[model samples]
Target: MYIEVGQYLGQDGVWLKNDETRLFIQAFGGMTPEFSRKMRSQTRDYWLNAHWMPHFKAPFSGRMDNDDPEQRAYWQVELLRQAAGTFPCAPAFGPGTDNIPTHGDTANNVWSLASARLVDSGGESYAKAVWHLAGEFELLKYQKTDYLRQGDSSHYMVMTVENNHDDAVPINMAWHTTLGSPFVERGCWLLDNCQQYQVCPQGTEFDTTASLELGARFESLSDIPTRTGGKSDLSLMPGYNGHADFISGVSSSRQLLWSACYNPYYNLVYVSVIPLAQLEDQVSPSFMNYWIHSGGREMMPWADYDGGCDRNYALGLECAIGGSCKGYEWSRENPQLLNKPTYFELAGNSTASFVCINSFFSPEGYGRPITGESQLTEMIEQHIRSLDISFDGLQAR
Candidate 1:
């Protein structure tokens, strides 16, 4: 077990050890176990057990019996058989559904409050280093905020990685999170303020297209001002309606944030974030990042979810910044072969920001209708400026 206290952020968090084992995050006041075993088991079975058949494995199994339906059917059956238990199946995995590889061999760093105690949740109480990559990149800085009206409760987990080599580097990153018991059940409701959707290749199974406009289109719009205070079961918007994929810019910039939110009072979970890229299209070694909030007496504010889960009395707000180990360079040079990597280079080092706030209810109760994009963008920019000012103040301290 490793205990790390991010004093500058004014909060504490934890982390668990091992690249292929369990991880528990307490910064957001939630605990979850890693399901890599199941992920790996399914991935391995897909590759070795499926026997690609007519597709062939080259030197080992060269296109055996091209016209054999028995062989093709066998391959199809094997694919479906393996998919029975695999997650993110078609919409998230695409043609590589059964054979999709794990994001990395393991999970990456998840940002939260002051100190994250990476520990063993299985009663071991082991404390591990929250920044296992500390040797590679020092905690350049940490920032905290109480944007959710939780009275110093909300937190923003930020870590800046500088190029140690004194030279420019390319990287791709994604925030992969696993939530424990009590996940969102099927037929539950979800809501999003995204005016547009960016369909990733992987999400094509759910909905092949994407959009960029949002407005008043809820099956039941309430005047509630927060998620916790609002009614359950919201409707999908006209067009761009599906699960496992969300409005692209939701967690980044001012467009969108948190991938999903839950009405714990009603036991109804809502996932509003989706994969922005596909497994086959993803560039190697990208970094996934987002935010998290928990331990509140009522509904929590919105958080990001580039990866990870919002679960177990907690919400995991993940965002994919870039990659580690100069992997983004690989993506940059091979843009045609890579997934939808953010064009950070477009704005250079100007510092871009994305914000997701999970309120107990929408702003409708405040006498404001769901103005979607216009209101969302305004709020995001405000928060970003506030954080910048806060960071400036922290430096003075």
Candidate 2:
């Protein structure tokens, strides 16, 4: 493997490539610009004054005057929030989650911070990155007004999290996993042990042909429905809903599981696997979520909505923890609903962990690796070990 340690949008980043594919890893891997410029032109958090992060901010849409400085600035905040809900940032093959540390109740530092280093030996290369709550930097854009006891937190385990649905409690850790927008398009498809499940509409205005249950036989991208809605659809609403009207659910077995997607556009297939054995695993997500985005709506926020994969669209296959991105409280409350562990903890950390792998299958793999799910599965089983991957510095035994 060949590695390039460089800067992405002024943030530290590493680029990796071999004969088959190329992938970018960042210190701030999952950070997205506060707003959308061109969906295709989005780099990993490199803008000068842009606030890129994975935040749970409110979403907004509709026409705004670009010429009006005040309106533009105000919309920028909303756009960033909307972008956070719509796009996944970077690919960090380690332990991280969405239950961010907050100053008080709801005040959170949207940007998840980390420092990543490249590890390479022989012909194999991987990333070794340490994740942390932002300490030295001013975490929030503004300060807390109320009496602060803990001051500002750099870790959620050190903070208090609460919801009306669940009790307010001292939280320790959560299961957090997500893959951003780069993994979608024509030949891009997710292979999982999915047999019938649920589909909950995340945003207020979401339109999907998806039934409450899905079959295991997904052979083509077109086999899936067009997730984008038209004029009133959230996908076309220009960052209006941060959650992006996503639909998700667990397997029929309803156990912690894994899923893999093939990205022909990138000449590789990405896998997101999760572990949900411990009750301390606060957040438990559905095995997968298919997030839809309209590149046309993103580019022209003021223009009319364009549904489907018109210009630039993304189909994200998410493997979430903490109740499918609901966070610690939700997972803790719903432990009885999840599958018990068939395997022991693989990492040394008390926090959530999993194995995420990506492999390059040449476009010319033809029927061998590209045609059938069994062929691809065997290929992954064979090559995944040679890659030498780890989630929390603990190698797979």
Candidate 3:
């Protein structure tokens, strides 16, 4: 395995690779350093007077006053756009009505790389990278380590948070794993062990044509009830529908929790897994949050009057401790949001850690939904065996 340090957008990040697969992990925000530098170097009045300012909708609209708090908050959050790949959302995770940015401060700030190395153990080679970041409140410390075995497609991650304050602090964390085109397109299917799902009403403003009723609960994603008295097939991705939606689900089976996105057209599948038995301190994720952004936001960056861009086409399969991406406060206030606890508290001067495994596979034929633990394991083993054969052929040549 090889580890390369670089920047994705403007945030510090790293890439892990072997013979068949390559994975990129970056700090939360998406803007390039140069872009961020330019924005920060300019005066606030410059952006206020700029044409782009008018494209922002309500709450941010008609607020020409430089002293307006809403306008200031909007500008601050805009700088944090473009967070890509797999990143951690900590302390607070999700979209809230509050002024905070989506996914909280951790997702908006840059993280520093602490170390990267390769280790050989038990006749296997593993590559690891450690990253560290401080909370905005400076009350907690966060560390995330990524591990990938040589010639393997699976990427393993462990994230830990330590409370520095003498008093316990509430924490909400999630692994925001995202996939974009050409890996994500129409006909891609989302398969999971989730037994029930609830529609989240937080980001409805991004799409005017959203049909799914807020707070609605359903069993299967293929036949979710919509406001139009119709059932939308969420199993497959929709084409240029100009609608965005958020849904949260829980797995009734406590053995292994997993979700997968399979693109039949490409015969490729991406799976995220968490073994319930391996979790400690009862910090197991309570739900899975799936976000479908199919060219829904017609705002600036996403769209402009002059040949706007298609800033959609991404799916987020997040394993979260919270019910939805809504902030901790909101989840606490509305305990009914989910039957399980929305957030967990980390004891003072103590630490809690979570583990997750994400794997990719390219089968020889059409791919199908991953339904159980044994199937997923066999698929991964098959992929590894194929890699070994290919490597042997190359050496023989």
Candidate 4:
């Protein structure tokens, strides 16, 4: 395995690569220079800015004039929607603290590289690195370790959060993995083991053209209810049709949770796997959040209606441990629908860890979906065995 370190959107990031594929891990912000410029070009009068911009005196700051607790809370919830990360990134949402930034301190602050090196075990080589970041209030610390093996496409990651306070604290976090461009074309299919799904109640606020029904429930992603009394085949990514939608669901398999995006045109698939049983007890009720942006947002950075760019075509397959991306309060209030607790309590002076694998590979056949837990596990095992990598603890159930 080879490692390349650099800065991504002003935050420390690293790229882990082998002969087969590569994966990038970075701090929350994944904005490109062009995207940043376009974000800055939006007028203050736009609905997005008008509703929340006045609350913050500066970018990514808590300084605000509003004394009302409700207004302040609204600001925190809206921050990530306005400015979020792209590609594979971690965005830690609440324990619902006012002092913390929108996506917690980890998302807003830059992380420092603690260590990086290559290890040789059983004649097999792999790369490992540790990255750390401290919260603004210094109450919690974030650490992430990445493992990439030679000649393997899969990248394994372990993320830990330590509570510095004397008392226990609640935490909510997720991996905001995104796919775009050639990999997410018109015919791409989203394959998952989720048994149920609920449409996001909060639709894209700036997207006036959005058509998905809020709070709708479905049994599969392939057939989702729409606002127009029609069923949408969400499994297949459609052409730019000026629409956007969000949905959240839970996988039926608790042992191994997985989702794959298969692009028939490229004969490639990007898979994200989370071994839920391997994670700490503090992380429970794992959920998958799917966000589709197809030229619906007409504000500032996503002015798709203006026709200069088609930057809004992307899919976010976020693997989360709490209630979708909703903050702590919303998650707590809406637990009945999800049938699981949206937040977990972490003991003081203790650390809770979560693990996941993100990989990119070309499948043997065209347009064949990787279905069921057994098949997914077999594919991962085969890939690892082919690389001659011995990952003992992560065996398939």
TM per prediction: 0.35, 0.49, 0.77, 0.75
Quantify all predictions' global Cα lDDT against the true fold. 0.26, 0.33, 0.63, 0.58
lDDT tens per residue, model 4, 193-220 = 6888888666235235556678788897
> Over all chains combined, what TM-score does candidate 2 have?
0.49
User: What TM-score does model 3 achieve against the real structure?
Assistant: 0.77
Which ranges of candidate 3 are over 4 A from the true structure?
9-11, 27-79, 96-101, 202-209, 279-282, 305-310, 365-397
Worst 10 residues of 2 by lDDT: 145-154
Which regions of candidate 1 are displaced past 4 Å? 1-132, 135-153, 177-183, 202-318, 322-330, 333-397
Compute the lDDT of residue 7 as modeled in candidate 4.
Answer: 48
Instruction: Go through the candidates in order and give the C-alpha RMSD of each one to the true structure.
Output: 16.8, 12.1, 10.5, 9.4
Which scores better on TM-score, 1 or 2? Answer: 2
Compared with the true structure, the alpha-carbon lDDT of candidate 2 equals 0.33
Which tens-of-lDDT digit does each residue in 235-340 have in candidate 2?
1112322223344445653333445656555545545443333234223334454544433332223222323232334444554432333333434544422342
Say what the RMSD of model 2 is. Answer: 12.1
Colliding pairs, model 3: 10-31, 30-82, 94-325, 95-325
Backbone clashes under 3 angstroms, per model:
71, 15, 4, 0
Better by lDDT, candidate 2 or 1? 2
